[model samples]
Target: MALIQGQSVDSAVRNALPPRNLGDAERLVSGALGAVVALWAIRRGGLAGGLATLAGAAMIARGTSGYCPVTETLSAKPAERQIARKQGWRSAAAAASSVTIAKPVEDVYRFFRDVANLPRFMRHVESVTVIDETRSHWVVRAPLGRTVEWDATITEDRPNERIGWRSDAGAQVRNIGWIEFRPAPGGRGTEVRAAIAYEPLAGQLGRLVAQLWGEEPGKQAHDDLRRLKQVLETGEVPTPALRRADADAAMPDAA
Candidate 1:
């Protein structure tokens, strides 16, 4: 078991690294191709045009081979994971933040069960639709507040226990998460746990913003729960279930 887990971790590490299989000749060929395109563009157009083509060709080579030399040289070492704690990623931002809700199991379950009720506590979520009994469409506001949409199918729906969901292929913000509701140890309240995994959009801007605004995601989760607890315990209007139904009813049917 130890050996298998070790190999699995190694495999994941290797997959994270850009391929270095290309020989020196291949690297030269890529550079030469970039040069050629740039030269042609310069002759036909100008320096600015030439530079643009050269950049494009360089991107193509790096992307096609999956070996970006720049990334290889600048990439940071992967963080060592604690033997007892296995979560988060060195390459991508990951965290599991949880909060307790002082509510009954059925009320909490009903609140989360309705897709339209998401905006109440889901800060990044813009809209949600119940396409059918276990499937839904979601338009989530991206990290930097851009609108991203995705379709998701609910997996596990154990009443008062847990709810699991995974985004379909077409989802803009691909994610998988489980919301678990467990009775408080002393029967005081319900303990809510959420574990989510996702990969953000691919781009330099996305990477930079993710790194810069790293704490915001976790903070949002915390704030969302605080707000949710307030709404659920206080009978507020921003409940996830109410928000969804309101949005759905407001939309007109297609002509």
Candidate 2:
């Protein structure tokens, strides 16, 4: 949890994505995996096997319910849980990170408020061209030093509040996420939270990469917010050509 002022990004994320149920396909796969583990346990001494089976069942239940007790305790809420059953693919992954900008809540919020400014700080973001008011084209630098391009559209947004989005169909990775900002304790600053749910293209292998990478995604999220703060507070971000275009639009053209 990162606090810009008195706000806790973790707490806002907890409130944004409420717990929900997993997709049918995820429930089915989890049940099957549980059954297999149960069979293996039966062949063994039954005690350890029973424990393993219980654990597996619990995982399946949590996946199906889309609610994990641990997540609840950790101040996280479920945003999306969709099952992609095409070509025998089954996997689940989630990550979150937050950072406090030294600046006030409104300043920090406005910086992130402009999705067009995302690539200025988000390292993994290669390009975010706003094709329209709701849709945009994104080129992402993959975790393993690779690049994949896709389209994303804003699904939900509440100014000075929250922003949420999802990937377009046929994307290399199925991803969804959101950002949240809130007022601080003494009204001195703000809290910022970022949450992402993504399934890589390689199934288990992708999950392995994510785990090995651990919280790199979250760390990057923090970095992006910090840079955003610097840019907003000091106006120091090397303005990109696109940003310049935005600026030009804001100024009047002398005839």
Candidate 3:
């Protein structure tokens, strides 16, 4: 019987309205609380108690119907636009890092081009599965034991030069990134430049959570590049044990 603005009184049009944002868990919890309150009010057995019971019953109905008038009223267009802007800022976030490795450009390029090798130096990456010649599936570890997966297609590939990739549609975390290899001056080694842009799973909130846990993306990229350099230079990533051994060996023996 309710009429929507600029619309006819048809069931089909009414059904097409935006769905309630309340998740299943929220509905279940609200309904349970409302039922308990309603039972308590009924036990009081008076005129005021009757009004309280009706209110509680209304709450149960709202939860069951997946419609909260207060929530809908608060989620007006202006609030929606503000949320969109926040998410957009997060989606456009990016980080870049560069490192010079004591290895030839061809060798470095070949190592990176093989996506499977990424997990060796990328601490957050759990695995990278090659789907085909130009496609790969990546799984990265997230906070609280969560893992995010995405399929990426190679957008650009030039042997010993550069490679670029973008995630496919519906990816859990949308992303695009590129890596370039250049010969260092005097053929000393390869200079690798990498950049990535991604939309965090929970947008800015997710990023802030990561930063709070000392896992910002920029810091991760910097450390990953350092690990890559160490791997290429020494055929192994440097560990605390290695550093300790090196320091001990450098110290003169106490007489």
Which candidate has the highest lDDT of all? 3
lDDT of 1: 0.69
Model 1: runs farther than 4 Å from truth? Answer: 1-92, 143-145, 203-207, 211-215, 237-255
Between the candidate structures 2 and 3, which one is better when assessed by lDDT?
3
Model 2 segments more than 4 A misplaced: 1-89, 210-215, 236-255
Q: Give one digit per residue, the lDDT tens place, for model 3 in 95-186.
A: 78999998999899989988999999999999999999999999998876789999999999999999999889878888778999999998
User: Against the true structure, what is each candidate's TM-score?
Assistant: 0.55, 0.54, 0.61
Candidate 1 lDDT over residue span 1-255, tens digit each: 999999999999988876774566666777776767766776777667867786857755764564776554333323212211232322333346777778877888889888788787676777888899999998876556577788999989999899999888766666677888887777767888876655556633454465565524456666677777777887674657988998999999989
* Residue-pair clashes per candidate: 3, 1, 0
Please give the range of 10 consecutive residues that has the lowest summed lDDT in model 1: 76-85
lDDT of 2 at 141: 81
Worst 10 residues of 3 by lDDT: 73-82
Error of 2 at 57 (Å): 31
Per-residue accuracy of model 2 over 1-255 as CA lDDT, tens digit each: 335643766668767865654556766776777677767777775679779878777876766567655434333223323333332225545667776565676666676767788888887788888888888888888766788888888899788888899888887777778988877666656778888766665755564464466424456666677776667656765559867888989999899
